[model samples]
Target: MHKTKISVDNIVDNQTFIPNYPIKMSIRDVDFFYGSQQALYNIHLDIIENQVTALIGPSGCGKSTFLRTLNRMNDTIPGTSLTGTIQLEGVDIYNDFSDTSMLRTKIGMVFQKSNPFPKSIFENVAYGLKVNGIKDKAIIAEAVEETLQKAYLWDEVKDKLDKSAFLLSGGQQQRLCIARALAIQPEVILMDEPASALDPISTSKIEDLIAELKKNYTIIIVTHNMQQAARVSDTTAFFYEGVIIETGDTKKIFTKPIKQKTEDYITGRFG
Candidate 1:
């Protein structure tokens, strides 16, 4: 693996990355409400290109709610509405010109549970490509192989491509879902408690995979596990009661948080 030294000064002096490295997504004064109750306050944050950002907070803190908003997943819920702007590559995703399907293709998502289709492993990974109208079998096969390799699951299931995806272990299934997401060539990957359902070993594998994936894809993970957030994220944002309380370097958030609420929560004093 190739390693690069990223200057901390660059991260501190500018919330944005250097020139030639434009941000992939930006959220400006975004608020979300379900019917009459607001789930997220006026939240403003920027997602840097090709970096891992973690959302950590107690349950009902709106971490997951905030994640879903990025890809317009919240639109599926009736009576739920959004106020303010969420931009992908400088264009508002909520605008009239925005295509929800195309936006979803650009911004893929992985849920907490490994919900693979009840189909062959090959078919599961190729489903997205097929939906996108890539009819050539060779093209689909090549994409499936490349995506699986990128997801770190090719070696395990390469020989059994025709086997049912359900036959794979929990960890393998999660990686397969990741492969499925990558098959569409997404720019950002949103994960909502993706490892909570897996065993310790499986969770460790997923964490390691996320660390590796940051090189090629922007990742935002919502995790209740402080240690997992610290292990996998470069920046950590602490949310509470539908607001972002604090966000900074992961080390600082864990060891020396500036806010009382952040400190209390990290120290296990309260939710």
Candidate 2:
């Protein structure tokens, strides 16, 4: 294992972990709340460009809450509010765009369960393009094919493009949803326990797909599976009770966390 030159001396009081690359998104001192209850507290994280950043913790640790905050998905709920700055490429996403549709398109999301549309497989991939106002059928068809290929689901469903998306198996359906997300060509992808519902084989497939996707897209994934986070992420952040304890290179975070709290959680001491 390669140990980084970064030691306690360079970190934020030897707790906050930062990656060694240019940040695609910078989240600074963010706090989020639903009514009177606060779910996240002063989160400071950096997502590197064109790499997979994994968020791991026990349930209700605000990992998912933080993920939704990336694209402002939490705004859909009533009485939820956020304070602090979240910037993409130095531009404040919330302040820059009054209409979040463009933001949602720029940062796509995939959920824990496979939620394919009732429409045909082709239409599922084309939905984003259509909604974004691509009127040409040929363009949409080409995009669907390209996106399915990019999602690694083209071969399985190429012959069945006209069939309903619900006809696919659980794993295939998840990949279909990924294809849907990719159709719009998002710059960032946020996944919330994307493979938590699949079998081992299906989970392996998603893991491998995530590896391939990061070559082109910046990805931030929230996963309960420690092994999955270690397998696919370049950087990892450990969250507990709305606070980020550590964030660093995945190898370092898993193999040699600077914080005792992170070490205890990673070693199976307690969630």
Candidate 3:
């Protein structure tokens, strides 16, 4: 990982987050269920435009479940349901946008493991463009290259656009997946432990990419790595047993948390 000092001056952090910053998305009184089991409690959160907000907690704390709710990924699961409202820039995702495909285009997701199509690297990124109805070959080609560059993978994979995505290393495959998500020009990127499966160097590159991407896209990341959250997120929300324990500046959450559970979890006392 890139060695960088963590101090107030080194961060653009939550304290400096203007109260007037536009809200990119909102989650209000959200409750989630998987069959008979309740997952998320009355969850309320705001995702700011051009900022990285990280969700952190121990295993099965519903951080990942809540991240999926933003883009309605849970809809695929049988007997799953969500209550209350989730809005993207004041538009109710459930009511205003019945076109789930468009919603997904606006908010793309990267999973825990890198998932590439059984095709060439170029085709992997081009797949999203094709799905979005871009038929022009020039446009698709330009987008594939541009997205790969934005993902910081163009240099490594540029010579092998025709090569199979499966042939790439795990880290490269993850970046390819990120490039695939970027090809759609999504406004928000939801990452669930995106760097967890990678080596340290690759993980650092992904973190650096996250920092750059947040200048154009709102990023919500779910991470079990507290250090990664501290480095990449402007604000951090700590979740426990499906409820938010505390949400605040990354500095405060790590250095001086308001809640005991938040402190304990961050200090390695308990989950």
Give TM-scores for every candidate, taking all chains together and pairing residue i with residue i.
0.92, 0.93, 0.93
lDDT by residue (79-191, candidate 2, tens digit) is 99998899999989879878899999999999999999899999999999999989999999999999999988999999999999999999999999999999999999999
lDDT, candidate 3, 1-271, per-residue tens:
1122223232223433457778899887788889978888777777889999999999989999999988989998899999889999999998898899999999999999999999999999999889888999999999888999999999999999999999999989998998899999999999999999899999999999999999999999999998999999988999888887777777788898877888899988876
Off by over 4 Å in 3: 1-18
> How large an RMSD does model 3 have?
7.1
- Model 2 steric clash pairs: none
* Per-residue lDDT value at 130 in model 2: 91
Clash total of candidate 1: 0
Candidate scoring better on lDDT of 1 and 2:
2
- Give the Cα error of residue 2 in candidate 2, in Å: 35
Of the pair 1 and 3, which is ahead by lDDT?
Answer: 3
Candidate 2 least-lDDT 10 residues? 1-10
Please write out the lDDT profile of model 1 over residues 21-120, one tens digit for every residue: 5578888777788997888877777787888889999998999999999999998999999988999888899994357888899999999999999999
Clash pairs of candidate 3?
none
Every candidate's lDDT? 0.87, 0.88, 0.88
